[model samples]
Target: MRWFMWAAVAGAVAAVVLAAVALMFAGGDPEPAGAGSAPAIPAATDAAVSEAAESQVTDAPSASPSSSPSVKPSPRPTLRPMDVIAGLHTTVRELVQDGQLKPDAGEDLTKRLKDAAEKLADGEVDKARDKLEEFGKKVAKLREENKLSSAGYQTLAAGLAQLAALLPSR
Candidate 1:
């Protein structure tokens, strides 16, 4: 009986250790939210991003893809770059609207992202992709700089990856 109990405890410990390992493999920034003595969102940037985010919840979900198979419409693009930007924009909007931004020099980087996404949705796939790539790079840079918040860069990277996958094989 004691052996069985020890086995169960060992199993639980193994499970916990495995979960921790998985989380580490999943990749996350070391800093926690509100960890760095700095606010994630700055007031000025938040306001600008919020204004651009007005169209975040787009009335039109999918823009028609080009006829070329390379640009063929995805029957279901789980996380299009535009969609990702739109949702993120909305979050920025709410953050600013809720006065969550700090007086710090941080600027609303969201508007620039939204504009880039609009270029994508407007049938400019190449441009969109370029912009998306740029956005991903920016996100990565911000993360490395410890300027990213709560998996924001990770989500951005995921969105870019989704868009890349949905594209027809070049």
Candidate 2:
């Protein structure tokens, strides 16, 4: 009947409208359900009706830019020599607590870090640099003796290197 064809067309139009609205809310382009292919309309439907439905779906407005929030990266904080020494101290203490480093070794390393910090605070750049070099040597020896894990050795060595770079050249 003529009424049945009109109803089918109306239903298809409503479905395309709903899909477009859903895509807008999802923050994406309102592409048709099956791009480059005929829509799933009844075989009795006319080509004109299919073409109209496809145009309605494709011509729908795209998602708004304001739908998604923009993000900006925060600036990285600069680390001072004393800060590196403090981090090294914490790393050494953790290693000792985890049984990765013997208490004696940890205590010695911690003392060296403390001394380096104090020397740095007193404007004794050379002395602080010497302490950092000593720490690096001790770390290497421990690694060679199998007393320090490779991870532990790497952590301490990197911290020492960073601290040395922060200090003034001899």
Candidate 3:
């Protein structure tokens, strides 16, 4: 009878220890918002993204005829400086034609864009990028002075951002 009582106590202690161990292995609650950190991604969403990426990897055709298939990296085409400058000019022209920007501002921006393109042609890439950044600032000031609509500002900003992406980072 005494041994039976001891066995019962040991079983209860073991159960409590197991429960504590499980809690320790489980992660704590997620951090609250406004904690000055990135928002936490849900576990399910992360798993889905991982699965999608893995499927893409498996779908790619094998490159070589080895015992195990190897992933081949596809080559991405490089953008030339002039090509990017031209794209900016095209976007600006559309904005002018749409009457979303003042004629004077458009003309001034056009001239500055042409100068930047010329700099790129001359192989002065850094100078060209500097000119582009300067032009972006000018456009922002003009948007404020003209009281451009939100749509107009977004259009101009998008063009500037696209051009900026093509330039090499300082």
Question: Which candidate has the top score in TM-score?
Answer: 2
Number of the candidate with higher lDDT, 1 or 3: 3
Flag the better candidate by TM-score, 2 or 3. Answer: 2
Model 1 RMSD in angstroms: 25.8
lDDT of 3 at 124: 87
lDDT of each: 0.54, 0.71, 0.66
Model 3 accuracy (lDDT, Cα): 0.66
lDDT, candidate 3, 1-170, per-residue tens: 64345335434544553453344346343334577776776667878889888888866578886686765655435556577567667756755666666777778888989989888888888998888888888888887887343455655565566566657777
Against the hidden reference, what TM-scores do the models get?
Answer: 0.41, 0.56, 0.52
Give one digit per residue, the lDDT tens place, for model 2 in 1-170: 64345435434544553454354447654444587688786655578788887787866589776756765545445557787788788878877766667788898888888888888899988888887778888888888987776656666665665666667777
RMSD of each: 25.8, 22.3, 25.7
What's the TM for model 2? Answer: 0.56
| Top-scoring candidate (lDDT) | 2
Clashing pairs in 3: none
Give the better candidate number (1 or 2) by TM-score: 2
Alpha-carbon lDDT of model 1: 0.54
Poorest lDDT segment (10 consecutive residues) of candidate 2: 2-11
**Per-residue accuracy of model 1 over 1-170 as CA lDDT, tens digit each:** 64345435434544553454455456643455576777666456877888878867677778777786554443432435565566556544433343332213124456556767788678787776676667667666666765554334444444455456544443
